[model samples]
Structure formats: C-alpha cells, structure tokens
Target: MSSQASLRPAVVLSLVLVVWALTGLTHAQPKASVLDFSASLGNLLPSLSRPANSSRIFYGVMFDAGSTGTRIHVYTFIQKDPEELPVLDNEMFHSIKPGLSAYADMPEMGGYTVRQLLKVAKKTVPRLEWKRTPLVLKATAGLRLLPSEKSQALLEQVQDVFDESPFFVPDDSVSIMNGTNEGILAWVTVNFLTGHLYAETRETVGILDLGGGSTQITFLPKSKKTIGSSPDDYIARIDMFNSTYELYTHRTCIKYLLCHVIHRPPYIIVLLYTPGLEWRVFKSSCLPKKFREEWSFGGLTYIVSGKPDGESYVGYKLCYQEVLKVVKDIVHQPYELKDTSVFYAFSYYFDRAVDAGLIDRTQGGMLEVRDFKKRAKEVCNKMSKYRPINPFLCMDMTYITCLLKDGFGFKENTVLQLTKKVNNVETSWALGATFNHFQNLKIHR
Candidate 1:
C-alpha cells in the first residue's frame, strides 16, 4: 500500500534483464545445509565493493520473499550511449531457507535473513553505484498466509534492515506483493524473454505460476466473450513497450488445502515439506497410506502420513477426489481456453513434471493436460515406485491436473509449454518486478 499512486508510467520491456546467471534444481534447489548455504552466499564476493566512476552501469537489487525461501537478485544494466536505451548486462542470484513467515513470532530473526542476503548485493554491486542503486523486496505467499499483525511485523523488520543498509531504499521497498501483480509481472518477463514483448507480432503466451502460497493465471484474452463474460476485476489494462494490454488475469490460492480456509486468520498451510514440522500430524489421501514422515514449511513442522492401517486404499482416484474439493467452485474458469491460446506453466508445475519423468529437468518440454492425468494415475497407483523421489509427488501431480482441468477449465488437449527459465534468466516475476521498480511505477488498483 505504500507505493499506490494515481500516476502511471510507460514500461519499456526491451531494457529489462537480457541474461542473468541463475541456479536451478528440482522441487528443492541446491540441497545445501542452511549453515553452508549462507556461508557460500556471503563469501562469494571478491571485495566489499568495486569502485567505478562511469555512470554507464546501473545496478538494482531485488529480494524475493517467497513462501519456501528468501532469494536476492542483483541486476546490472548498461547504456552504451546517452541516446541509446539501457540493456541488461549481468546478474547474480542466491537464496536462504525458511521464508519470512516462518519467523512470524520472531520478526528480528526474519530481518537477519534479509541482512544476510544484503551482503550478497553489496558484493555484487559496485561501491560507487550503491547509493544510486535501488534495493527492494516483495513477499509472496508465505507472508500473505500469516496473520496480519504477524505479517506486518515481519515487513517492518525488513524495512528497518533496508534503511540501515547503504543502498537506496525507496518508499515501500519492503512489502507484501499482491498475487495479481505477481502473475502480471511474470507475464511480462516470459513474454519478453520468449520474443512476444518486442516482436512486431502481438501474439503472446499465457502463464500459470503455481507456488506454495498462491496460484496465478494470466493471458491476453483473444475472444471478446472472455472479457465480456468474465468478472470485471479479472480484466486489467496496462501499458508495456508503448502498447496497451488488456490482460485477463486472476490470482487464486493453492497452498495445499489452506486456499479455502483463508477466512480463518492466523493461517496455516497443509502438506508442506520443510524442516522442524514435528508438532502435529496431518493425514491426507495424497500420500500412500503406509507412508509417514515429518514435513516442514513456513517455519513450522508437522508429522504427515497417508491414511493408516484402517484407511481406504490411496490412488489417483482418491487423491484427485481429495484435492478436487480444494479447488471446486472456488476457481473461476475463463471462456475461450480451448482455442487461440498457448500457456507456459512453471514453478511447482515444472518441478512436479520433472519428478514424474514427464519432462527433462534441464530443458523443459511441452505436454498436454492429459499427460499430467496419466502420470498422476501411474504414480498414485504405484506410490512405492515414486515415493522414493518424493512422498507427495502423486498428490502434487494430481493437484496440478485438477487445477488445469477443473480449476482453470483448460481442455485436456490444451498444450502447455513447461519451462523453468527462458533466455538465461529464471522464469519468475523478479525481472518484471524489477522493471516496475526501476521505473518507479505506481501500484494502481
């Protein structure tokens, strides 16, 4: 709410990050211990800061306060000549575990994580550019799921840390980003990297980003009926690359089963795999009945298990039925999905597909809606075979299938391009968000 202004600016996507060095792994990335990971990230810098006099190079630091983890992205921009527009030059990325929400009761601890990631930014950016460089952080599902008082406490702590740092901290530098913006920013990043943003042709692909805390669907609706028949708020008008885009976008909750129970404050997520979740046990059909383990996420731990000795048999049918209730009637189905549209699904979508051998981990591939259904059936039927990889793989796959088909109402044959990154940068909202911040765009409703 800090940067919500009436005046808006034209977003030039051409100047966004051209290539950023990013790291990617499976559902969980770089399984390094928290101690070693923090050490590695902090010690990567050759010097405290590089001294440079030329103003041709610009730096921006963006911290992604995600539900699963906290990551820092340092982006460098260069303009060869004063008349020419700036383009991306270089970037560095790193992350730490247990998102900000995990420290709901201990806001200072959350600030410590931000402080640690800030060190990476200092080492990445030049000393001369520190004062001019913008440092900002936007939180996603994790903090959004916490109690208002608790989430606000966490943000305030982060703001304090940002102010103490040498980098420039603009108004609303640390805040919880709405899900709709998350989806739209991602649309910008993907379209630009995929050649749709700057191309003469206006053809752009739809995007589906399913994170642990929230899920988003955004696309340029081709059919008039879609815009006319849908809810008024689902339609958003924005300017990008000097063109106006009336995109059909919606932000839906998909944090395990917590999406529906959002009205209950002091929120809690279901079926998350994290550390220190040993207090309570959660049972779901998504896992094998005989399976039992400790799952952790958002700073809390819970004992998770499939139905015990007396529970009914667990398989695709049962798992789908259980996860279906979480999305039924709650998610809106836009018209014209079967024709004239292509979609790119990433985040949890790509991770689960990789776990099921449905796509290559390195180079993502395409798949029909039914491919998920088929894989979900195979994995759920033989949980033993896939359980070694991830105990919740069957449930997660089933959830994706249900979300695409029943939730968003996509046709079974609808083609979805699954990828983790495009053009060397991670396929995320960070780049698009950075563009919005670098230009100081207002957050308009």
Candidate 2:
C-alpha cells in the first residue's frame, strides 16, 4: 500500500510484513527488521503521542497500476495489544479501467486516473490523518511492457498527481513492480491471511496466480533439492516469522517462436517474458477452428487463431503438445510438489474454472489436477459450445492443464484450493504489496 523506504526489493520483506501486521513479533525479530520508526498502539505513526487507553489505528493507501485497470486499496489497521501484531480492520477498494499505460501519449489523462482514485483515500482516511496515511503506486505488466521513454513520461505525470494529493508520498512511490517481487507478494498475501505464517507446525500453501499479462507460482519447498535444482534467479531465500524459507517462484511470458511468429499475451499458458520484443503475427492451435482475428493488447497488435480448418485435428492432445513447448525448460519442477504441497490458485485460474462450470462462480471450491484435465478435454473438443462465450476458453483451459501438469510437474491428483479472497480481502498482491511498502521493512535482498 504505502511505504516510506526505498531499498532493494526482498522476498523476505513481503512475507514478513503481513506477519508483523497480523501477529506482533512473538518470535525472533526478522533478519530484515523494521525501520527506525517508533512503534505505538495509535492513530498516525512515528512518535505521535496518544491516550494510553485509546487503541492504535493506522491508515494506508496503495494504487495498483496494472495492465487492465488501475485499482486503489485503502487499508485500516488496528492494534489493541502492544505485544501482538496489528489486525487488518477494514479495506476500501476502487478501480478504473484502461490502465495508465493507455495514456502514454497523453500523460495528464493517466494522471487524472490516479487523481480520481485519490478521492477514495480522501474520503476513507480521516481529515486529520491525511498527512500520515502513506500513498504509493506500483505499475505491473502494463507499464513495464511500454517503451522506457513513454513509461517514464507516464510515471512523471503520476508523480505530479501524488505531489498534489494530501496523503503521505514516500520516496519511489510510483514505479513499475518487477515480476519477481510480484510473485513473492502474492505468496505473502495468501499465506499470511490463511494463518500459515503463525502456525507452530509451520505449514504454508503455495500460490498460483494467472493474469492476462503474467502468471506466478510460489511455494516454500520442503526438500533442499527443490532449491538446489532451481535456477538461482528462481530461488529466493526469505527470512519470515522467525524462520528462513527458500522459495521457488516463477513468472512466465511468451517469447518463444510458435509457428514462426509469437502469440504474445503480456501473458498465457500465463507469464512475463523477455523485454524489447518485436511485434509479430502469431499462429497457434490454441484457438477454435472457426476463430481467427487481429487482437490488440498492451499497445501491440497480434494476429491469433486456431489451426486453419482441415489443416489439423484440434483437441486437448494437439493443444497440449502445442502449449507444452513454451514452458519445457522455462518452468522448473519442484520436488514432491504433488504429495508435499497444498496450493491455492487464483486470477485467470479461478475465472477460467468458473467459466467452464468446473467450479461455482460465487463460491470457489476445491479441485484436483484431474478436474482441470477433464474440463479441458470437454472444452477443447466441444469448441462450438464454448467458443461463443470465449474463444480463448479452450486455449486458456488447455494452457492451465498443461502448465499445472508439465510446467510445475504436479501429479494428476494434486489438490488445489482456489479462492478469490481470504476473509474479505482480495487474494492478490495488492494487500501484500500494501504491507510490503506500508511497513518500512528494508530487508537485505
């Protein structure tokens, strides 16, 4: 949400902040301890005097500048005990579509979106608390995919807007969030809220998040092999809840050749890929036979479609073979993922499951690896029934199945609990990001 410090991003800070928020540090202090700011149970922060009997209340404002939309999260935290962590009391959320990147050529318009979202903070935070409530903005795939000059121009405009706001504007308040931190933050939100971070037995669930622009797989591996076998960049040693965890996380992007050109979805089969990509037409068996069109996203045009009529028989078999090639060596398989891990999947994973009647739309339920396989088979084979609802349903469903089985190497029986939110908070990086920045936890990377 809002942070007062600027330091090298660390997975440790992201995981530890929520624990500090929910349960006061009962365990050992993190290797990455809190900032020098004084801690008190009260309104505002940093050495503010308060009535001894009054409870502590803190406010924060975070703006998520994502590819599809810009969302604002206004969080209220309360502390009733000095020895325990602060409890998340309430959250006020809002958003605007066609993210700031759409206004790259007209930077002021993008500033207006940030300006408009600021009003939510103005209303939610008490008048006297405005000066203390920190405001921050972190852009994701949308801005990161833009040219450096254009992205910088847009960020400058956002800065001007932040300067005009009444809330606290920390250093480096507006910037693009890297893919690695994005993955770690999502893991923090789910694990912290789910009560795993505080458990004495120390069981934590892995997180799978798929957006239109990126996908993340994050979990604490039980075996040293999962850590040693992974590429260095894919493994992060994070100190949290008084323990050190070597996490295996990856965010994917489509850059490989598919048919000669690329089928660039800022994500799919889900991911963020190599930067400085060239625009090209893409062809794949990932679409319906009757589907063919020029699609545009993230300021680039991509021509995508299923295999031509009569060219090839398209089914889950052909689709998996086509999609499997993208993640062969790119995604690292964790040791004993199927037997040793508990997972919660969200984002595109949830939406597509709901779309295919695999899970309830309102209340998401537990699903196994084979459930997705079963659903993928039905959709990929019966395109005529599902295509009108979403032409990409077959492709996306197929991608989810393949990625889970092949990319992550989960057995067919791996159970995945998919949810859109925990308690009332969204199951997303925003809540975790808020804590990541909200607390000035600058742990060593």
Candidate 3:
C-alpha cells in the first residue's frame, strides 16, 4: 500500500508540470505573431524595407555636339529601389572645340573626334560598368545646318565609333535634335537640377538658350492668352514622371531674322534662309557706326559692317527698332511674365552676360531686363571705343535686350538668372536627355 501511494504522487507531479508548460507556450504565441506582423509592416514602407546602400549605382555617357564645340558628360546615378527615380550623384565633363560640323566633309575626322572623347568616358566611368553605361551623341544646330547627306554621313561615322566602343549603345543613339525638343530638354535639365521638378510647391522656371545657328525660348504658360495667342506649332505637351506639362517653345535666329523678303504685308513674310560667307559684307544697325570686321559663325565667315555707305546708326533706339522687326509679331507674349515666373538664360545668353560684365564668369548672377538695356545703350554709344574689346558687343547686347523686352515681352524689372551650371552640372539638355533615355529603357530598375 505504501509503494502505491508513492507512485501516485510522482504521477500527479508530472501531469502538473505538463499543464504548466502548455499554458506558457499558448500565451507566448500572440507575442510571436505580433513580432512577425510588425516586421512585415516595416517592409511595406520603402524607407524601412531597404537601406540606401542597397540601391544600385550606375553610370551614363552623353555627348553634346553643339555648333561651337563638342562636349562629353559622364554621369553617375543611384537608385534607392526598383520603383524610385535614379538620383544624379556626380558628373564628369570635358569638351573639344570646332564641333563635329567642322568635319562634315571628312566623316572619318568626325569619328576620330568622338573616338577621342570616348577615351575620356572610358577613363571616367568604372570599367566594370562599361557595358551597362549607355553612350549617346546628340548633334544640335551645327549638324541641322549641314546638308542632309552630309549630316547623315557624320552621324553614321559616329555610330560606327559607338559600335566599336565598349559602352552600351541604343538604336537611335546618334541623331540631330529638333530645335523644339532641344528647348524642352534644356528646360527639364534646369528645373530638375534646381530641385523644382520634385518640390511640393511645384515651382518651375523658364529657359532661354541662344546657340550659333538658332535660339530658343521655353516656359510653362500660366495665362490662357499665351496659349490662345500662340500658334499651333508653338505649344507642345510633354508627359514625364507621371505628369503632363504644357510648354511654349519658339525658335529663331538670335537677334536677326534670316532670309530675303518674299512679300510685305502687315508683317514681312520671308522663308528662313541660311546666309554664307560668299556674300562678303553683312550690314546691321546694331553694329557700331564705324565698325567693320570679319566674323565667323556656323563654319562660315562674313565681313560684317555697320553700313556700306557711311557710319551706321548705333543707338539703343535705332537698334531696338531693327531687332523688334525680328520678333515683334512672331513671338507670343506671356501675360503672367509681368509679375510671376523666373527665367534661367544660358548658352549664348550666359556667355553674353559674362562678356558684358553683367555677371561673373564662374559665379553667375541675376539681372533685370532693364540691366541688359542699360548695358546695350552704354556699349552701343561707346562702340567706337569698345570695338577693339569685342566688335559684336553692341549688337549682342542690344539684341538680348530687344529679344527680352520686345520679342518675348517681359517687364523691364523682370529678373533673369544667368548661369552656365547649377550645382556642378552644366545646365544643358544632355542630362535631361540622359534621364529620358534610361527611363525609356527602364534601366533604373
């Protein structure tokens, strides 16, 4: 009987221990479930899902074949995640003068120029990333002015060079950019670099680009009058980054209207024509009354003079009238320009501002439209003395002033930020075009 009682006590203690362990485990199950739910919730958030270092870093190579020079931009970018836009980390820029157009007759020479630039790209971009980095060459007004066959020959040569390179090349890698597309891309570049593209407030700026063969003006028109008054071809709708933008674009010979007059009506009608050095002397009232010299543009040289007969009219008032004819009725004035909208003028605009001492060469500054007018008057009146400095200063200044005040119809006090670069990157269309190319390919992912 004593042995049986002892065995019963041991069995009862064992059952109690088993019950206690089961109860503890059931209570702990809810805690384990909560921990797993919290982890999944964290993963649903982009920031918590992956760290910044988890993003892939890549590179891009872009060549800007402009009228005066050819430049290469090697860019490094980082994508935080497959769903995010790539961030531009840095850029390596280099250029060579006497652009690809200089080699129009000798296509091989043009290819050689591109080949040399590829070396720079090869050195700048990581060797391991070469196959992933896209190489693109975009020719601007320089090639646009060339004969179609000649332009094609040059582009073909560039394509051959690109094919030989180790970098990635797209099918439409080498081509001439239309003036309208050029302006729009430039606008995107400036806005994107300025952080205006992603701002919560959605602020954006206008862009003015003056090239050797053509000039462009682009801005988002807030006023209905601007859209209504503009011609059908002047307005363009661009879809980017899940947003649509209506932009106003205009192209013309900077400060002068080219072409012989066909007819004279309320406005002069003329077909756009390209003038060559064969016509030795070109006259303009914007030139100094006593100045005459040899000037070159777009691979053509011309003996430009004030007048063949006598001293040319050199005054802001006279120059304004001459320049006004080029843009008066053709360019639609934006109503919101009177008070709103900021403009970033670059290329020839920036160069001219620097030459006129209006802004620093490296660190650019802002100026009012009136500032250009004031400088134009001073330069035009003193042309006889300043001719040695820069024979075209008077003409260039007057043209910029008239283009802004009479051509585009900005108020005198309206501000214009003149810069060649924003943050370290050049404010050119190449960067934006690079972004467009990669986005189209979905390479960021």
Candidate 4:
C-alpha cells in the first residue's frame, strides 16, 4: 500500500535493479537454464535510452517473470553507432527456475541480489563480460495475479538488482501488446516468406494474435512505390515499402474460467486428438435457444465433452445430452430444462475403446470441415437479422487500443483476427546492438 512517491527518487531507482536481482535469485541453477535468440537492434536503441551522448555503451534487458520461472533478454548498443544505427553484434536469452519461496522472503531487493542475477547470467554466457551494462526487468500476468503486497514486495526486491530501476511493470496489458505486436510481425514475416503478398499484392495486412491470457489484432498499412519504366523497377521498389503499425486491439482476461473454476491457482486444460469417427461426428453444436436467453451472452454454447484418464483425455463419446445439460445449468442455474440444448452432436475423435454412439448422424445433421464455414455464415446472418449488434465486442479490450492508438497509429473500423503461437527461442540482436553502445557508461547518482 506504500506510495512510490513517498520514496526518494534515488531510493526508488536503486530498488529497481535490486528487485531485479532478487527475482534473479529465484533462478536457482541445475533446475534452471537460459536461452538467447538474436535480432537486429539498430532501430530499437532510441526507445531504450537517450542517444545524445557520443560516449557510453547502452545495454537493455527484457525480462518475462512468470509463476513457474523467469526469462531474461540482454541487448547491447555500441558507442560507434551514436545516432543512425544498424547491425547489432550479439544477443542473449535465457530461462531460469528461480525458486518461488526465495522471492517471498525479501522485504526489498538490494545490490547483493543484482550481483547474483549477473553471476547467473554470466555463467550462462561464459565468454561474455558485462561491465556497466544497464539492465531493465519486467514481470508478467503471473506476478500481477498474486497478492498486491507480495507483488509489490517482489518488484521492490527485483529493483534492488539493477543500477537503475526497471522502466515498467510487465502487466498483462504490456504482455498482450507485446504478443500482439510480435504476432503482427510474425504474420508479416510468415506471409512474406510464403509469397502471399508479393510485388503485385500491395494491400495492407492485418494480424491477429491470441495468447494464453490475451488477444491482440493489429493493422499495418504499407505503400508500394513505382520507379523507372523498366518492368523490373517495380520489383526493386516493392520490398522498399513504407510501413507502420497502424491499429491493434489487446484483450486480456478479466474474469476467466481459472478464477471461476477450481481455484487451485492455475487452470489447466489437456487437449487430446482422438481420431476414430468422421470429421462430421466430431463437430461442435450450438446451445439451445432458451439456454442462450438464460445466460448473459446470446451466443450459443458449443461443448465437446471428454473424460480425463490421468493426464490425458481419453475414451469419450460426444454427449449432446450431457453437454446441453452443462450449458443449461450454466444458463438457468437451478432451473431444470424440459427440452435439451443438444440439437446436434458428433462422434469424431472419440476413443474407440469407450465409444458409445449417441446421436444418429443421418437423422440429425453433423458438422464437417467443409460445411462448417457455411453453417457459421448462416449463423452469422441469422444473428445479424435478430440482434443487429454483436454484444461480445463490448467485453473485449477496447481501452488498450485507445492507449496505443496515438503511440502506434492504430485505426478504427477494421476487423482483425487474433492468434497466439509459442516461439521456442529466438534472440533479438537489437538488445545487444543497443546495449553495447552504452555498456561502459557509468551510472551517476
């Protein structure tokens, strides 16, 4: 509950690095390891620190602290590239299993903790030497979901690890935005690689990034330039398009099933693909009309029922009756349903050993991959005719879009798809390029 303003700027700033180091303490080794991926850092230097000084090497670090473990990214900016820069030399990324209880004990982090993180970081990269590299640490939704005091204490502890405090807390908003931005870049990168949008296709692209706890959709506008009369001139200028991040929407979990269901902290879902029945029998069906009225959302509930055999979900029949019962219970609560919501059901992906055919596919129509789109389109049309306005939009992350609009040039009136993909380990060279520039700069109190 302590106000950051009450603390002296020096103290506040000093705590930043200290807390960073304390969090690093959780990276107890043997159980923990670090991975580094490289990227071009030339453009990102300005955002990390001031480039006015011709002297001093500037370095930056991106940290992802979660409930399970922590990951750190180290970036360097060299003094040679004072203003206009390109081509970063080195990048490092790593993960550490810093024990949870270790962080809980600290009243606040201090210089000692930072030294520990540095030691671990150096150990991971034996050849590398860090002198006066500035470090920035950020936490994720895992830390935010914890108790306020615990979270603040953890932050304060981590702050003690650095010469300067971390620039920001790794809130869900930031994570969602980061994932969103990365998704946009990834989609562009993938599309460019796939030859979807080439010299001929000059249309702007939109990226949708849906993450574990967040969703982001971005719009990037790019323009193509035409040069000489030579037919190939256009191809030369094709890759030289001017592009900017236009619009993006970030959606983070406010009240999720994890918070609602068994409050053991983490809600886990095991996805098992059982391939036995046809695709038509495996398709999901709509909730009953009355069930829709019973719940806050007008949209029908689509359920796929399965039983967990140990860690894996196995041996299942698509029970429209049972699925409808759950949905009806969710909608009407105590009210008993006269007519069930399971109008249709599928038998696809059900374990062959424990399979019991429930619905006759010929009698009651089933969904297939090809016809699913048509069914969805029909549903959309029907909903539009009845509801006119989609109510789900009201529950999305519209406020965050407004915040990034001016900063990133987001636009309005665009429909975007959001998807999330896990990246194994990729380093951004930008960190090393930027950090190397100021690695030797001493912090003045």
Question: Please, what is the TM-score per model?
Answer: 0.75, 0.81, 0.77, 0.37
Give the alpha carbon lDDT tens digit for every residue of 123-223 in model 3.
Answer: 87788877656788999877887889999999999999998888767667888987778888888888877777666666789998765435578888877
Residue range 1-445, candidate 4, lDDT tens digits: 0001111111101112222222332311211111111111222233325556543334455554544456565543343333433222233555566522236656354224444455544543323224323344545445555577776676666654543332211111122112222333344433332233343554444333322333333322232211121123111111111222232223233223221111121111101112233432222222112112221111332232223222122111122222222222121111111111111111111110011122232233222222322332343223323223331111111212221222123233222221111121121212212222222111111
Off by over 4 Å in 1: 1-55, 254-326, 442-444
- Please, what are the lDDT tens digits per residue for candidate 1 over residues 1-445? 0111110122233432221112111121122322222222211222123333223567778899987689887877664443344556565778898789889999999999899988888888888768757788999878877889999999999989988888866666788987789888889888867778776778999999776545779999988899999998898877655567888998876544454322211112433422343547766677877788775554566677887664356888888887776677768899888785679998778878888899999899999999999999999888878777777788878888888899888989999999966755667888788777644333334
- TM-score ranking from best to worst? 2, 3, 1, 4
* Reference-based TM-score, model 4: 0.37
In Å, residue 2's CA in model 2 sits off its true spot by 20
lDDT for 155 (candidate 1): 98
Worst 10-residue lDDT window, candidate 1 = 1-10
Q: What's the residue-level lDDT of 157 in candidate 3?
A: 97
Best by TM-score: 2
| Model 2, runs deviating above 4 Å | 1-53, 256-286, 295-312, 442-445
Evaluation by lDDT, superior candidate among 2 and 3: 2
Error of 1 at 47 (Å): 30
